[model samples]
Target: MPSFSHDPLSPKDAADVVIVGVAARGLAAAARRAGLRALVLDLFGDDDTRELALAAIPLRRIGAFAIDPADLYEQLAIHAGPDIPVVLGTGFEHQPEVVERLAARFRLVGNGPPTLAWTKEPLMLARLLHNLGIPHPQVFADHAPAGMRTLEKRIGGSGGWHVKPASESRGWGWYLQEELQGRTVSALFLGNGHKARLLAFSEQWCEPSEDAPYRYGGAAGPIRLDPSIEASIASALDAVVNAAGIVGLASADLMLTGDGWSLIEINPRPGASLDVFDHEPLPPLLRLHFEACRGELPDLALLTPEAAGMVRGAGVFYAPFSFEMRLDPLPDWVADRPPQGTRIETGEPICTLFAAGRDVREVRDTLARRRDQLWRDLSMASRKAAE
Candidate 1:
């Protein structure tokens, strides 16, 4: 459990919303910008998350990834009260039935469990994209045909941590997907029950670990694509929204394969790309998400790229030690901050690094330097710890 620096400053009745997920800082921060007091229940009560949230409770998982729903539903009123709307995020993909339970108890604010159940099934998504005439890699349940180039992905997973070379998989709940050679780009969109609108796009990259080879590093963009391709992706996304009955904020991950772009996955809730697309001249995304769920999408003009838009990027910097190291001070460019003096384990994420500039390289370079600095600072701290 994450320790709060202090007790919640207000009673549960004061919260305007409650968010639940593996990580909820970004959602809580968005709520704060929308002038709403958000109570957060997640896997981390990081310094900034606790600060942004009116109250933050660290939720326990039943096993590896699924949040213990009984714990979450039980924690709800005691932390944020009965009537507060609940916004779901990253951790729910593998456990949509828990989503069903939450909806029965609270005013569920985004895609419901039925939609999730339909969309998150790996084979179902592959077939749906194929049925829609949208290009998608072939999905294999038992095995990929002999000599087929493929990769194994967790059945209902996020953060790309579950992806690995097909030869490395032990199967079970995993499925094999034909390998597609290309970079990944995501379209963050608003779905108003019937249709969806693309808010922005971002190119994704990974920071591989020995075990989690395709672990998601971060995303950076509103990157440009050919007009024809953009139209096609938008069309495909709309078809998916209508077909899946998707609602509120979601992102479709598409990869540019040799044949063309292939739709890979649909995150039925707000995702990491929010660190890129959520900003002004745009209304608060958390607010837009609420309105969209209520059956209204933001006017497209408000999202025009020329209005205060610029290339920006965010990257995740993981702890670089086998031993624990206390984070001395939070850097200015960091979000998802663990408290000062908190020890982060080797291979765990320390904080999210942000940078914005005239172009991708500028932001990329700046973020690289930030990571280098953390690498050095944390190294020195590790040495001191050993001493």
Candidate 2:
């Protein structure tokens, strides 16, 4: 078992940093690349994450979908001390106060609470982008905007699981958005609270669940782009980062249409796509993130194209039905694996699949093949378990 408690302030016994998030594997992996030991407050306690972490506490034990801030505070008390750096990942957007509390106790190396507050608020973001003459989908806060292709989205939602048809149902903190037609594209960048640097652009896709159609499936990148489109995106990111005073790792989601890219939202903390872009020979992003937070920008070398004709992709595989995990030995290509014999509900993510190829189509085909192979392997394992 990974250590849950380390001797406070003892470098020999303590982890170098504390990582808290629903998707902590990428952060943990990045930390290890920087030669740092990570104590990860993770939701899944995935098998691969445990291998990379000094400690991987299953935040799922506290709650499946959302985290309780009090539980996180208590867990930190057990595993970390004030000197340790804390980097938050996805899942803290709606709880800025909790981030504020963490900042008061530890050295936070990413954007602080105030950044999340401004960036995640739908109306505020729409207005900011509008003021900057950026294209943004119309946001309706109080009542639904009649006669527009609309979506009902949960406030501060990251993955699209919280989005649904505007006509189906509505609840508190839910706002209506005009659904624009386009390909989903994202810019993974680092900011120094004033100037910004573009890391890479990736294409994002949705893997529809039984309930959620826009649920995030995967992303692939180092995608080369037309110079004009790239310049427009770079300019937009610089403006938003400066206006929001965003620092450290951040991402801007956009809709690339027949006309141009429209701003969707800016994720202020470390994003899920770190796994897509972080690789060998490139300086580990976590190291760059720290430097950026300290007001230093990464070298332009990072913006250079990846090696000719090579691209990488990451995809999530959700369970087809509720079942007990029967694969005893997990595959190398898969990540974020739950323990064998654990029960997983229908539509819940079972693992992540990684693949590489010359272009997007090949990468997608490889991931699909891997997913099929995994399901077949599970069937054989389950039958053997019964025998």
Candidate 3:
């Protein structure tokens, strides 16, 4: 049996809180530190991160948890816990039936009526953003936009899924016209309707894998967002937040153009880059999470982008190590000096290198240099082993 801690902090009162989809492990951890009785529930049971999950809850008062959403009813039936607050951290596609079944049982933050309605179709997200007046890339469906380059994208994809989903769903995929001419901006939104607040905003770049032509190479950080483009981006998303009645975190992808911004799509949950946002100590985003969990607005606002200049540069360096379609282990030299937020995955792409710098060039150069070093080390080691 797993050891349980019964310290005073555990949320003995089940009604106080709960969390779903263990992927939002960091947020859960923060909530626990704040004295919320949080527990993680996911389809996959405890693994190496379960300890991390437990730490996010009160020591002794940690509420009961279920392993999978499918097992939720069973788990709750057995524990007879309170109707705690639930935070959704899974992807847009993973929602659907799972959310519908549990909506009545628990209070789901950031999700309200119509939140999942528009997601049933592919281009609905883009349409919603456009209708809401947010600027984004020119969208093409069934045909390409006139006089511009276009890239295909899937309806409900995130991170690795971003490219793969588009490739597999070629015929039904939506096209993003390059001619729209705007920076690729992503926003993390919190709250409902007109009251929604923009938590974090940054640019994103998409890279394709060389070996797996359709597979995404992962994202690089700190895509430069022109200060002028914030208004267009904000206007577009506020409409969707109003329409959908979403309250938690919603990520919007937009393209800024001379004429206006075009809507790319919206992600209604915590995104992969959220960890990058956390490193900035932005108050609005942090305050939003706490406010949602506690049901009160934090008078504190996020630090201005200028104030966050101390840790100015940040980016994720995707592992490029591949051999005949298989991901290889990290070479000693590269693994030896792993950056602070570096993450390595087995049986997948090698790892993701996350680093920060004082400026864009500094950050980019640091990542480029580290990447080269990792490459050199790998080459030298291979030769030595071969000899």
Query: How would you encode candidate 2's per-residue C-alpha lDDT over 1-387 as one tens digit per residue?
Result: 454455454432468878989868889998989888888897788777888988788774345578777788888887778888888998888778888998999888898877776688888888888998888898887566556778888888878898877743375677878888989988889999987898888888899977899999999876866678888888888888888889998998889888677888889988778878888556788988999999999776334345524678899898887677899787888888788877888888888999888787888999999999998888678668778
Ranking by lDDT: 2, 1, 3
Best model per lDDT: 2
Worst 10 residues of 3 by lDDT: 57-66
- Cα RMSD for predicted model 1: 2.9
Best by TM-score: 2
Candidate 2 steric clashes? 0
* lDDT, model 1, position 262: 88
lDDT of 1 by residue, 279-320 (tens): 876678899899989989877732334554677789998877
- Which residue ranges in model 2 land beyond 4 Å of their true spot? 1-13, 60-63, 167-169, 301-309
Give the poorly placed runs of model 1, Cα more than 4 Å off.
Answer: 1-10, 62-66, 167-169, 301-306, 323-325, 385-387
lDDT of candidate 3 over 268-322, digit per residue (tens)? 6665546456554554343466464344444434335566664333233444543
Structural similarity to truth (TM-score) of each candidate: 0.93, 0.94, 0.68
lDDT of the candidates, in the order given: 0.81, 0.82, 0.50
Runs off by more than 4 Å, candidate 3: 1-17, 29-37, 42-48, 55-82, 92-94, 137-150, 160-182, 211-224, 258-260, 279-281, 284-287, 290-303, 312-352, 368-387
Worst 10-residue stretch by lDDT in candidate 2? Answer: 300-309
Q: Residue 330 deviation, candidate 3, in Å? A: 11
